[model samples]
Target: MQSDLTNMQPPCGQIQRRTFLSDLGYGATGMALSMLLNREGSGQAASTSSGAATQGPHFTPRAKSVIWIFLSGGYSQMETFDPKPELNKYGGKTYADTVYPDPFQDPRYQERARSVVQVKREHDKIMPMQVGFRKQGESGIEITDWWPHLATCVDDISFVRSMYTTDNDHAAEFQIHHGRHKLDQKQPVIGSWLSYGLGSLNQNLPEYVFLGSYTDTRVKENFSPDYLGPKYMGVEFSLDPNNPLPFGARPQTVLEKEQANQYALINELNRISSVEYPHDEKLRARINSYELAFRMQRSVPEALNLDTETKETQRLYGIDENETSSYGKRLLAARRLAERGVRFTQVYLSGYGEWDSHQKLKENHTRSCKRVDKPVAGLLKDLKRRGMLDDTVVVFCTEFGRTPAVETRGSTKMPSGRDHHPHGFTIWFAGAGVKRGYVHGATDELGFHAVESPHYVTDIHATLYHLLGLDPTRLDIPGRKRLEIDRGKPILDILS
Candidate 1:
């Protein structure tokens, strides 16, 4: 009976029917493919009832792709970009000891801080900047010596030194991408929204791709589509070119020709199922996803093939150096994917909370900076030289910044490190629509608050959407009414 079913072909006028067992085995791939595709709407478009164009870019798009580089733990704003010479001057002094107004006394301190857990403020004494800073690039932006490579590219970057978020812990990692505190309901991340609102520039690859390590399961929320459905979730890729995708490669036992034949049969079956249940959105999505999954099996590996790149190009990403090789590969792959039309590529330069320098601020930050600085700078230079930077927005950000005050609880009684400071931080952007070599907004002299042109995490989302020609307000579904905060106003000051 199995042999008969496998060999049988339906007459031209009649429908082909297979036994349930035959369908079950061969249909598994298609079913899995549907889940992989995560196609929730029609081909290349969203099915929102907002009466807005679902295939987005509601206005003229300045960027074609986004390279969102996230450092999992907080990097100090004062030490990195904000450069608080005051911290060094006021070292060992309490907030009241400083001649300047006490930061903790500021009315906005309690207003901005929404701590998930009660934080013990034992670190009362202010800590000076652990690293030295030098003016860099034509912009003369005062960057710490740790990021000597990235400092060279400062003239092309726009620094927003006053970015802040409500979440005061590691949860801010999720908030940076989704624009909501972890206490609040999970909303669709920026990458997911972009996936929902826009069509694929490369049909073979996912609209949103995640590269690098995410061993911390909680970080998964950063790429989730949530209400947008599973298909819109960021598809993670392995740096290993031989095995780039998860469950994406064909089984060795199944010859290429045989698998192709099976997919064809599945397609026919899906086509028949579609006609029988024309309104089954899930079925339609599955059909689309299966097709894409098949294409991805071939295309994704090629996109990750760094060996094909010249020795110079490899060195350009710092791939030759042991210190920078791992992160270099990811950034280099991101550039490859972006140039090939991947809409959004989220690269984790380090693992979860790796930058959370609760202790050893100098040691931790120096090692962290070394791992990413060269690769990041290389990405910018390569993008510019290849003309990809003209339409690719590169965002360099951390979850938040370390506190200006010293942390005295763990082991060290002396002020050796800073605690988590959600009050204010710095994030930067380069390429695409943003003005080059400009600094917008700032922290107070003490680096304890976002004292100028402060922006919530969502403002970054709004800026990205605007640059990509998406109207965040218009990307709504029928039932999901987003809050005003969720649809944050774009930072117009930074836009070119």
Candidate 2:
């Protein structure tokens, strides 16, 4: 019976179903190919690789890499590094009569202006900074009451208090990341520029890496390589302390031999396609991406592994504690990447209400400060101890700043929080050629605006590139002209 069944033939019209199915599959694949061809011909399928080999900065640089620490929400200059006594004297009064001119009162901020007053009415009278200020180190720069840990390292940092931005809202977030006004033409981020200019120091590792708690909110689709193409865009890593970069671990079932076989088959197909379309940059980029993906499969995992680090070293970064562990691990990872020649690393501080202080100004800022204080100070100390500080530049910045006026909305008796202030803020720089134990700029009597020698975000970018041995003005790509936004003058006054 089994033999008879095996030899049985189907009816005339049902002549081998397998053959029919294979023909249908081939027809569908051909149709898909035709559609792809049509799309390419219509320019709907764009290639993002044509701008890969642009010449970078023109001059010899001093620093090889940078580690950026971005404080997401506006950190209050008055509460943090910039101490002002006038805010205390005129605490509860409206600045409606002052020369400060309600800079944020434009029609764009009408809603925010209304909300600010409401918040102020409910919260406690313009609260004085809970923490005291002290002159630290030989420089005698006044640092806020909350940052004793950071104060100890003042000799290793340059504090710029007169930094200002054009945007008043969270949109400044985009401006700082992309180095252009939020309203202007979007440009490649500072990191992407560096990746394009320097290429990768470690082929196994990405040239640009972003790690932090607010990774999702911070990543912009426009946070891309833009005209420089996909090759220069940063490789974003998850903020997880254990595993950061996506797909950084080894595959369990896919053995080396199987991967190699698959790669060879893909390569053969790509080669044949390349012959048919020799001028296709997209095809070339795809081939390069496959090769990079394979290399990353090996290099990323090795770079992320923290088991080799000494237990004491881990503890020094506050990895042993819960509150500080996550950010601490990120900082340590950044340091490790810096040591391994990663050109750009950004570590974001996580958690809700991180420097926002909408309601509980004292409790909120204090708690947030404690969480990062040790890890940041430790990162600086560790870098200096290892002699990496001389070559690596560490930047600490916030989006904007909190207002000097008290916010009283939501409650009338609670400790008032500050609103967003874009006129003036503070940022600190350490390592590379930055002058240590120095303060470069200042705000006025009320600490409301940058009244003395104000600097913009572009100045920071220029200074950073200068430290990294690149002239910010000279980086250029072929064919595409450099825009005015790309030509930034370096702030030489603060350079060591």
Candidate 3:
């Protein structure tokens, strides 16, 4: 008898009952398409590093996975990790009131910002910090009162102040990973670099995974591998157990055993084609993707199902709470992915522009921090308890930071919020090879500039590469030359 999938009725097209893929995956039609796609600089060529390339990882690696937690809109450096008590000391004053040099007054500001001047440049008043901070743990790292849960994890984290980026717009979102101004050039994101350079541990899951809401879906450059090719890009998965892989489910009519047989048959056919096209890396990757997708049909669901986790474990992740539930689930899933050997998992919190507190920084940040604080702390604690901290790296960062000056977009001086400050901000790293309970670099008293050992965005990339035992410089392709800036120096001081 014909399988239910084969006999199933269709709504608009034959997709519901479609069976043949050999025509597209093989044959003369496919060969010509492959030739056009893989032409030099076309970014469709076979990977330089074979699947999970490690002909001896550059050095003995410290971390096996990275959980990159990115807050969608910029969070305030003054309000968050870099507590600028000076903002409270001299509130409602212009930059001129301070003895420091005007950051924007420098001739370099104009060129670096690409002419996107700070909103109300000179006249923008300094807004007082919205929250009070206290030292957390023995590290004496001062964190704002808004993040009690995260405060506990501070000793496990190393706060990296003096972090800056040039793109004044949300495009910094793209710049943070690409190592180039979003408007200027396109390059592979950090995840893609890792995915390309290192071999994955699990065959069932993607090496790079993206989980977050995007303000503009197109700016997902964080997961895109422009030159490394589409195969290196991140694969986004749904959190829902029933549809975690979304549209990757097995056919309704076919039983699991029958579906497995069908997959075997298709793989045999693809293998026959693989023999005909022995040099076609794209074809090999395609077949591997099919095999992976089948495996994911079982793996992803099992991984995402919360019912399997104990009630206490669920509560620890704040999965039982309403306000924290959504973000908690994402972090928990990220931890699960890392545990399963996914190399790089990028998790985004809140909706697009959710953290951009242009006005009322206190109200906006209080709620925003509450949503993620517990969940993040729980992930850290869980990982530590499981001994994963010794091998897993955790990162928390945003696009840039809110301005030290009050953001009076419409000339409302005391609107009580800050604008985007690309001059200086903060990010933190924990676990793996990174220094713990440490503070590296600093901004000025007003948190205006990265006064102490400032690092460009790419430095974070370099640090991650070092931890993963991949050298960005050595991973270059033959025809494509990477700029020196793209191979940022690793922040050695932050490493253990």
Candidate 4:
């Protein structure tokens, strides 16, 4: 009674591959990476179908796609990027009326007293910096006033402000995308650990995509890949550039060359059941996810075609506005899936606890930073005028910070919002191999502690596997293990 199909079908007895290749040189990394790309198209031009370079960030990598973005229900590190002008010079006072140091008598919040959520009357008061800072570019840095278009790209960003998360509630949005602790032991996220260890410059797509939505039902661990299974999870997408993978397309009563001869007779019956299940790595990742979901229906409708862009690149991602056209068409379909190499797209802005201001910390972060500052400063000025920001890395984050005192639940009155500060926060980074207009660790004079040099959110997944060159301690998984704080580390003083 339900199925009318929208995209992604295969389930109900999977394993496929009736035909070998669809030809037309399938493009955008499909038809099994159009038989493994060469001639640059980057994603590091391809590897590991054997010819070696083995599964890893083993070495040399600046980045080859990581868009990331984030932001759900927790945006206020003293009203954006750790600003605490001494909480407006001691706003209303009290952490025992102030000279710092009382984050509930530390001990990392007393050994995570059941992961911090009891504040009903604790709103501690002081709540000052409700937004209004200046400085901005030439690296003056200050930031907020609801990001006047991400403060003119602040010298291609860097920030970091000490971040620290242990889940003070809102599962610190699953500990900022599964760096664990939402009740522990749950690794594999960093787009399912780079879709289970890299190697793909596009192959039509889904080398990890997930674009938006999450009111925090434990935020599907932001694209979980639990024991690194389900073919290294993350997929999600839907810019609907003609049904981007849900019930997955292909019905108009079937004839698109009869749905390409019904997927070339189901890839000749899954290439004769992959020569009798030859060690089935999840049935060869479900016959390469059904020939990469049938070549991502012709390359995700030409990478979610925004009428092939331009009108000043659709008003530089404000997409002809409407409060920034729904997160500017999902950050312009994550910069057209990272200039067509799709290693880990992510997105998720607004909605689902819409930056949970708890009351009205200045009208909920001034309308969630005007629904995402001009589509994230037009995706860092269209990835730096299409040079794809030195190998594409981005990352802008949220999910912990707000409540430098002043979040009085169940009416304590005069406490207009903010409560959930996993002790400290702020995040930012841009383009591969970091360190640009910079600003690294600090928070306290009331942002309440990430004090200085704090990080620990899998050191932002060990600085995105050290800018996609990988080595999150030699990635591995045969009987699962992971942990040395899940190999985090890499802040290496913000790289580059």
Query: In model 3, which runs have C-alpha deviations exceeding 4 angstroms?
Result: 1-56, 107-112, 115-123, 411-414
Each prediction's number of clashing residue pairs? 1, 13, 2, 23
Q: Which run of 10 residues does model 1 get worst, by summed lDDT?
A: 43-52
**TM-score of model 4 (CA atoms):** 0.38
Backbone clashes (count) for model 3: 2
Candidate that would win on lDDT = 1
Give the candidate order by descending TM-score: 1, 3, 2, 4
Order of candidate numbers by lDDT, starting with the best: 1, 3, 4, 2
lDDT of 2 by residue, 1-496 (tens): 2364324587877854324433432232222222112112212113323223443445677788899887777888988899987666666666664545554443423422222122322222344665788898888888887887888899898889988776666667667767666566667778877776777788667778767654354454324666666566666666453545454333556566666566566567668666656776555554455555556666665676666778988888788989888888789889988888789997766542367777777888888888888889889999999999889999998878877777755555754577777778899899988898888889876666676777777778888878877765556554555565445557677898
Q: Who is ahead in TM-score, 1 or 3?
A: 1
lDDT of 1 by residue, 232-268 (tens): 8888888976678776677777676776776787678
Q: In model 3, which residue pairs have backbone atoms overlapping below 3 Å? A: 52-199, 403-419
The best candidate in terms of TM-score: 1
Among all windows of 10 consecutive residues in model 4, the one with the lowest summed lDDT is 36-45
lDDT of 3 at 413: 51
Error of 4 at 483 (Å): 17
lDDT of each: 0.83, 0.69, 0.78, 0.72
The candidate 2 region of ten consecutive residues with least summed lDDT is 35-44
User: What TM-score number comes out for model 1?
Assistant: 0.92
